[model samples]
Target: MLDQSLLSQSRAGLSEIEAEYIASSLLRVCPPVSPQHTNLEVTKLLNEHPELISIAVVEDNKPMGLITRNVFMEGMAKPYHHDLFDRKSCIAFMDKEPLVVDQNMSIQTLSFKVLGSGRKTLNDGFIITDENGDYLGLGNGEDLVRVVSFLQAEKNRLVTESINYASVIQKSFLRSSRESMAAVLQDYFMHWEPRDKVGGDYYFCKKFDDGFFLALIDCTGHGVPGAFMTLIMASFLDHILLEDNRHDPAGALAIMNKKVKTALGQINDSAAEGFDADRFSTKQNGQSDDGMDTAFCWVNTQNSTLTYAGAKTALFYIGDASSDVQLLDPDRKGVGYVDTPMDYQWTNQQLALSKGMCIYLTTDGLIDQIGGLKKIAFGKKRFSGLLQEHYLKPMPEQESIIMQTYYDYQGKQKRRDDVCLMGFRF
Candidate 1:
């Protein structure tokens, strides 16, 4: 048996690419030497094919071990080695502990196993087997490297194309014009940042005769799936608003919740509450656990009032120079929970506005970001302090300060989720 100590060391800290299967490079193998094959018979077979570096020793279709050309030649070169051993079975010198890999094993993983083996290199080659442990073929370290490199390049290209397309689609949803938003709330800023090229977070702004509708929403997941949900949400919200000309924040939310449930076929899913429909039925069953947490606000400068409603989202408010920052909490439930009552209600909270007062609406992404020395959440307390400290600045300046502060706090940490923040002053 070969010392496999090097293989054990190489297995540590292997990268993700090593997790891929070896099916692409699988080679056909045949004419394995039996354990009973005499060394003279094996030598003659090897000599006939000088190019064959190794041969498998198998019994009943199961691989027993491997024999390399170098070992055979070295043994034969020994004084009287062939005459003394040629008639003996080749199994006496076969590598019983040779590197063996399942056909489905990833090439990276196989490399780790081979390199970690106490051998200086995998020059002896290795054996591949089917799931049932039937001998498949012999593979070289060099060939494995070539195939894996090609596969990884192909995988990277496909992913890049998909992400670029998704980025385009996500940008299209941010269609609200600055003029339209300014017509409703004279001074406001909306910041939308996705954790990836595309994200699960989005902001919506629309103006009607009574006032303007503004919202920040965080969907269930991030990346492509989350981006898809954001598209669905934007479409549905627009359709709901136009259907009955509903402008009230709470009523709009109720419509959105019902529509999301119906779209996902979760209207009848009380028994499997919260079950992810997408996991079970990707084609037509729609999404389960696919809902948004949102903060919706209506501002009417005519009456100097702000009305807001939320589904698992909140609002931060600071009125005038002397008023303390305030948090307007949302209901505990988000939109589209499977068990949510069709008749469920949302609360519409109203507040009187003073000159130079600021209102903030955000998805949980901001407060939930992981960072700090302890790697804890940024939290609502710190968020509130940020707003309170900078609310006095112009809306545009405030946006810059907030973003810079958030990035400072985040430091080198990976972004945790999509973030959306909207601020306005009356």
Candidate 2:
């Protein structure tokens, strides 16, 4: 039989860190018995310690096997069983192959091992050993489960806190941009809704001496990955606008395309000569193909004209003289992919601005949202109809009506993506 003092020594030696819990922390004081011990001797030990579900069999301080309480008692209770095996060695009834784990193993790793070792190990418990394979004690599967659950909840709490902080930063950036627009425009309204706490869709506005530069960008993906892309895109746009291309919408777009390709390392050998191929390659041994679709407008208040340019995006305008809503379609290609040419040039569509003419720009998220009785996209037709119907209303009222209509149509369907819409009346 095992010494009771050894169990006390093992428990006194353990010290846990706040960082993580290891296998040793799950150890319980279950004394081991030699395999040469008789069944009658094992039975007496069990009777003395009713709390132990199983006992380890060790020889020379190294674990040999295990004998569970239920299995041993069932065999000993059979007719003529006591006479045949009461004096025999406990090895006759001990499990030869038992689940044994290192005391230093992480709780996460121990959980996996216990699950894979089958139900018997979980029910009867398992042996815990030191580094040199010496028997330490036994571990309960129930304790392991509780620790795993607590760790998972703590991890989720930290992740949620970080994401919420990111949302605050993103909103602050957007609010600053909106203030810049408000300084120049006579009347304007913006409806920005992220499918998550933070998203990839963003709008930018910068006041210029001529009038102002405005853009609505839909970056690749949504949520955290997409939100990261928006920051990258914003940095590039700020750098590009600092140049002389503030009044040139098409020229700004061309420079933006090249910059995005370079920033994301999406450039091919033919597009970027002397580029570091090995240095720019992603972890997957390939370049990131991520890019954004954008609608850019350079409004010249002095010239009474608006120069519009887009890459896989469009602009809508309703003139004060007409009830019809006009659409200025964009180029058929997107910006900053391996497929788009490095020298690709977008054309500018200049339109004469009029008093009380309302111009609108939006990301695809608003149109692609799936809902309504037929479970169809909100679509351009429905969007144009809403604009035409409510173009004469005040900017704030128009925003409210448009958002309410969108929500009513959406109903119980899940939001598909980040949505951003901007409108201004000149």
Candidate 3:
């Protein structure tokens, strides 16, 4: 009897049988092609191979570039787009280094390639290639998602075997506030992210005995390290509330400003020379890069008072009427970028937040998300309009409205930067 046990492989206790099935089914064969074909011919080929995506633009049997469906469509729609019908070759509109994969390349490598091409349209897809630059049919985006989904199975096997335990490692770094005083928070929800896993944007909600604190912090960069800094800052905020006692919102921010500048070590000496780059590693290694921007606030909901202190973070508040939406602008200097730290003057704004009023905090992400292939952003003005339109909806439906509007604006393009949106209803 053929050994049935040989057919199964375990990862984190989940079986690879599903993964193997997917890998095999996805690698299913189809009619493949080469480049150097004309646009007219390629369009015809797409009709036949309707599943086709990228095609290498080969000249003299050597791959010159890639012609993706988007590039072709974009070119065809251009105001100068007239020669497409009688085009000599697809090379004219092809992407020189369009994201590609080699046949022998590991599946991990392939998975990363698809992810790096940024996000794609529902029907939009990617192409596979051989070492010799020959086309190997199309690869569906859903297929890559399936591979990651199955990796969880393999990861589980490792966990069960005690070889490795990585479950929740992806989310392990996210933490909650420690000090619980008289924190009174009625309700709140938010999504803070960069265009990537690591976001330079952050969110914090600390509940006090009588009031609560919140912030929408945007750091220096756009992705990767920027996101890492957000995590570090989040941890820093947690520690500040637990240890340091900065009771008022402005006081807390002033303390935070001093701590941040000390931590980032962006200060100068008597000679006007900055701190040694090498010695700055004591607190922050500066190895992965250091420094960030910020905005801090403390709202005494019980007392109906809002205290604001900003460093490069724009604030928006929407009340029952359109007139209630307000923007709290920051000074020219960000937290780490300034020479002399300014004294924190608490600007207390009195407001009577009725049941229908809302306060929104966001980084540039929400408004800056790519609107279309033409490259428009969702934008501040329109985003405010969206808030007004959804203000009438129940809190439960409001989240859906915001997300739907984001996707509708972003469509299928890759997110250019992190998107942060926090809305609080009274």
Candidate 4:
């Protein structure tokens, strides 16, 4: 049975030309009969082939008209009607102007034509013809709809499968847990949530020789494209810190800028001596601006100190209630762009912390979220207040409280982006 509900659903607003079904699929292979064929012969053919809804009436190998089951049956129901017409040609009862459709016509347009062609054609069916006006076969209205419905279902199923697979890959790239940092971090909290099943925002943590290398990264965009950038960024960070033995956060960023530009073939746009103005001008400007913003931190437990550097990312620190909150700014440049000078330097800040000081690393996704009664941004000011209000709470409890407060403020507003908030106490 046809699902009446599906008939009303739009076909993704695709134009008739874009729909997959054309005249070929809807066309049936029933043979055409000569116009001279008698009514008795036509009745025998339709009786033997119950599925044949219509057959073409042709003369001299050219389509003359269509004889549908209804016209044949109704004509035969009348008393002595067959006796008079039994010797007559089938063309006498055929629809002389049955609707004929071109082979290239979309199913959507075909269905529309069928519905508006008057009630007589409701069961008369349509004729399918090639571009050259040659008779192909007959098309039943019911069959064309079924083909379109199947196409829509298959497209939806494939898209769902692709998204689920991408979600698995995105999760594999995330750090297992902030709890793993307990040995050196003493107390810590982390909240990472992607607005979509797979998102571009992610955090990385790896225990190094003296302490730990931790970073909160936000790639160029969100969803699959952004997620892909995370994978690339992760690979580059791993190589820079582990294989190259580079540990300074600022130096690592410098290498990151160079490598990312090179990987994307944006080296000609760099500020280095090799930069080519003609080559840069010939290409579209800002075409290779894809990159990441990151807060990179190295906690050196060996010296009981913390070092930090940022690439378009920020750090918030609090020593105690007596101390004012400190905001450390990152270099005003992204990691993989040609806009900044090639010799652009990333700076590092070393902080001698109190035994219980708290430090935070976050992406703009958290602060830039749009929510609240006024529908304004949950800006830096509110974030600062949130951390300060709950800094005294235990790390785990603080995490829960902060998340709950965030949700309350968000209310019914859709999440604007992927959010990642990290806190560690010395």
Q: lDDT score of model 2?
A: 0.78
lDDT minimum window of 10 residues, candidate 1: 271-280
User: lDDT tens string, model 2, 1-426?
Assistant: 122343233234223432357888678868999978999999999999987889899999999999988789988989999999999999888998898989888664465455445446666789999999999999865455434433433333332334555576567667767888889886889888899998989999998787888999998877755765676667567757756797888899899888766655566552233334334344244466677899989888898999999998999999999989999999977788767777889989999999999999999988999999999999999999999999999888899998999999999999999999989899
- Candidate 2 or 3, higher TM-score? 2
- In candidate 3, clashing pairs total 22
lDDT ranking, high to low: 2, 1, 4, 3
Query: Which window of 10 residues has the lowest lDDT sum in candidate 3?
Result: 162-171
Question: Which parts of model 2 have CA positions greater than 4 angstroms off?
Answer: 1-161, 270-285
Angstrom error of the Cα, residue 242, model 4: value is 1.9
Q: Kindly list the per-residue Cα lDDT of model 3 for residues 1-426, writing each as its tens digit.
A: 112232122222334343343323344344433454666777776667654555555554445555666557656667756564435666666666655555555443344344334333112445456677665544554344334333433343332332121112113333343122113444545665556545567666677665677777777675444543554465456546654343454566666665555544434431112323333222233321244555576766567766666665666777676654567776545654445353544333344566656777777777778776677888878877877777666654777788787888788878877777777676
Per-residue alpha-carbon lDDT of candidate 4 for residues 102-127, written as tens digits (9 for 90 to 100) = 88886644644554453344445787
Q: What is the TM-score of each candidate against the true structure?
A: 0.58, 0.61, 0.52, 0.58
Between prediction 2 and prediction 3, which has the larger lDDT? 2
- Inter-residue clash pairs, candidate 2: none
Cα error of candidate 4 at position 102, Å: 44
Q: lDDT per prediction? A: 0.71, 0.78, 0.54, 0.70
Better of 3 and 4 by TM-score: 4
lDDT, residue 79, model 2: 100
User: How big is the positional error of residue 260 in model 4, measured in Å on the Cα after superposition?
Assistant: 1.3
